[model samples]
Target: MKSGVTNLFVTVIGLAAALVPVNSFAALGDLYEADFFSHTIFKFTPAGTKSTFASGQSLSEDLAFDRFGNLFEADGGSGTIFKFTPAGTKTTFASGLSGPFGLAFDAAGNLFVADASSGTIFKFTPAGSKSTFASGLSIPNGLAFDRSGNLFEADDQSGTIFKFTPTGSKSTFASGLSFPVGLAFDGAGNLFATDQSGTIFKFTPAGIKSTFASGLSSPDGLAFDSAGNLFEADFSSGTIFKFTPAGSKSTFASGVGNPVGLAFEPATGIVADISTRASVQTGNQVLIAGFILTGTDPKQVIVRALGPTLTSFGVANALQNPVLELHNSTSVIATNDDWQSAANANQIPTSPVDYRPPDSRESAILITLQPGAYTAIMSGKNSTTGNALVEVYDLATSTFSQLTNVSTRGFVGPG
Candidate 1:
């Protein structure tokens, strides 16, 4: 018999409350700028609303965000690196550097700084232990990391962009530039550099270089948002320009005082869960929810289907027994019929948050997934039809990965 479901609603809950500070107010996808002349860090929303994120730096040169959303600033004028909580409390992360110019964070939570005056790159452990990572360059101005953990640096005086292996083996990635000051990498592995000569350049993973944009006013720092849009700090013109993936340009913000560093807060907040409440049925009428895991690290998540528990939440026609199936690109990866009987039932309760199903007949699957797309489908056992709630919960939020682009599909109208 053909059946349908109506009012199928889906909600993606981001665990931002745990990562964002009480006083800090920047949403994900917002752009942050280090205003050098203003001695302030400015926050610009995606719609161009401006606010002061942090203030009182001697000379804010570059900005980077740790996994926890804390902002790190390079103050070249004071030769110090300042760390600011999301709420704006500031502390010195490192000091005594010779003209700190750039900041970046690797997957391991280590911080890298470019010391322009000393022509060196320094690495700092999470515990504040410092060590020389690379040296003897000609004015290292900007630092960035590729997915493979290789470090890229722009040498302002040498007109070259150098790539360094994890062990500091250096090789020139591109050359013949005019004062390249800022470096960034897009999701597709392409490198972008801002040349103070009023131009921006793009380099493929194989080192093929081409001009991305030209006729800028001393473009200094560049960064990419999750959507692959490039934001450039036009140092001399006091404007921020955004370029789309296809090279279309537009103004993102203006009237900033010598913006030097630009960074976009991660678009996907730590995902708490994505829940879909729909009428569960059999065959092609079942509820299916899809999501993508992005970034370079693996993420642990719990998928569950709640049927009887929905009765307590005003769902009267709840399915007594629900079934859940997880898929990776059309192949069934896992399935569960009862939450308590799953092989990893013991580990389900230990998730970062308590996410145990209330009824023994409910279904749950706890698994760790690599960066990819996945789907979870929920249905009623024995071809029965009723209301059911399917959910996916992220358990490992500290990793450099996130769950995003959640969607759902099901038949329309009640089954």
Candidate 2:
């Protein structure tokens, strides 16, 4: 029970990739939105700043990002597609389109556009050569390409989704959709769609369809983030909604007029790492782990320390009592002796904060922090020693919905 010998380990459960709400203080991602009525495209940063990404267009209906970081927008009114570089440089990539609505890129760099006015699907080469990939559709509006190079078009007028092979042969994929207008695919090869009826639908690789979510205000576009969070643009409400892989929904951004396109930057911001040990005591010294949070806003995080409960996991000699402290450099910001202490009880309630250690002797704290490096320390109370757990969870993204436990599993010992 001396003050310097120990071991530790932890497991974290938390939020996935999606557009985070601005107030949560975490940058969801770099997002580009198209205003169909204004004929403008706007860029939103994770820091909650909105600015013009590109403008001077005619009815920018949909957006897509290629592997090289170029942004593409389909101009329905001008019957053209415009491409933009990261520095906001714009150029016409394709023309002679007939009210292009949805835009997508295949793995080989070919572009596919859904022509609403002509009821045809057009394919564009990297060099701008255009050809009719599929014709005779009843208003193909939203387009998506699966991993296998299968092209999908949402025929809004016929309420049928059509799937096409890379060779251009087409077949009906699903029916009964209400004016389906946008389509996206997740990493697992599943398809998601939104429609004028304010519903979002999910489809399995085998063509099984199910309602992923309902009751939106005319959702028009669908896109997913690295962690499987689905984002949808609502044309009527001028808002964007985020849905978890499990179908939980939350408002991501709001107050834009006639939003038609929503695309996440093909990049990630918050990468988390956790360190663990089997046991820690005062003799083992305080277990300290550090992390850096980028951006200007304060990041809301939950920090916790666990003991006693490890016995359930077959951990022998679980720390009888573990204490936790959060620090900026060497300055202590918060500390906890027990998780349910009145000081932090108000902040640690509800589902996103679920999976609290069952042992009353555990410790936890919730903090909103500015951009910088910080450290979390876990130690046994009164120099008592045993197995324990320490974890830091980012709360900015999970503030609205089902944010599970933030834990990490690892083993640690001094050299």
Candidate 3:
């Protein structure tokens, strides 16, 4: 009888563990800023904590991390490249250039520096030997590399993108940009860049240029998240804007002071790098969550939940009904009431939803889920087909696990 009780207890514990929700873990590193005037590099953690990385430099414009995790800063005013270890040991890696603005690393771990004043792109080895990779033309400010090792540089003076081959041959990939400064490439090989005139542009590998986003004060630096969303640093307004691949723009962070350089730390998974022109440290980490739902009668679907903490809820419809829930994990959190309303108003369809429509015909829903483990219930009835499906996304991992399908009635929690 005791052995039988032990078996039943084990089974119940296993079932309870299966019902518990699993959260995707994300560690957001703080944003560090190297003030040009103060000549200091300040590091900010996600919890609004601050530390000094390095100090006593001259006009640091851009920063890049090496394979060994050492930070490299472009001191445009001094025409030098400052290299610092993670613990803040600073040294001059290279010097005596003519206004190096942006820096990037190639696949082979070579450093490419963009000299804006000389319109030149210089390549430097880890040993500090510098050579002119490409020269002559307009103000080259930002540098990026594609998967195939081709280099793309953004010219602020010409508002054009120059493609440099490994053999040093250069060609204009796209033209008619507005003082483009920062350049970045997405997973699809599409190039995204920001201009001083407050516009973002996207270029295909085939040389097709299109305006991806616009109407900013002065977009200086550009970066991408794991979800393919584009982020732009606005120098004029000291704000950071997040843009969807479809050209939709939203304010990611604001109240920055002369924000210029932007880089995403993939290890931390945050969007903004947030370096200002001055010395006061101010930065924060913004968490983003995404959800996708599909079914034949999604319009009849709804998500209901009583959180473990139960703060608020909302939703959005990137394609169909996208619901968001917010809970008070601590004493108080940011206002997430709008997200809850958005969730309640959004509804899913009853048919299969395709992310890429037409042949597949799937619908997608996006919502922000606050931190905590809670029970989420999705329910809908399709009168015509009697088929419904739901999917949950853990945005931090960039992984998608299907929760329910045609034969499933509803999802109690996570799988």
Cα lDDT of model 2 by residue, 1-415, tens digit: 3455344543111111122231222234587899989889988775547888887889889998764468899999999889987788899888887898989876545689988888888888766778889988988888887756788999999999999998988889999878999998876678898877878888899989888888888889887764578888889989877788888888777887888988876554343324455546464355655555543223456777888888888877788898887877558989889888847565453542363668889988776666555667788878877678776666543111122222322335443
Give candidate 1's error at residue 28 in angstroms. Answer: 4.5
lDDT of 1 at 327: 86
**Candidate 3, position 198, lDDT:** 64
lDDT of 2 at 415: 34
* Model 3: per-residue Cα lDDT over 143-223, one tens digit each: 887756688888878878889887788888988877888888876778888876667777787878777777788777776
Top TM-score model: 1
lDDT of 3: 0.54
Error of 1 at 257 (Å): 1.0
Model 1 CA deviation exceeding 4 Å by range: 1-28, 272-292, 295-370, 373-401, 404-415
- Each candidate structure's TM-score, on Cα atoms with residue i matched to residue i, is 0.66, 0.58, 0.56
Position 357, candidate 1: lDDT: 90
For candidate 1, the lDDT comes to: 0.82
Which candidate, 1 or 2, would have the higher lDDT against the true structure? 1
Among all windows of 10 consecutive residues in model 2, the one with the lowest summed lDDT is 11-20
List where candidate 2 sits over 4 angstroms from the true fold.
Answer: 1-29, 268-415
- Scanning candidate 3 in windows of ten residues, the lowest lDDT window is 273-282
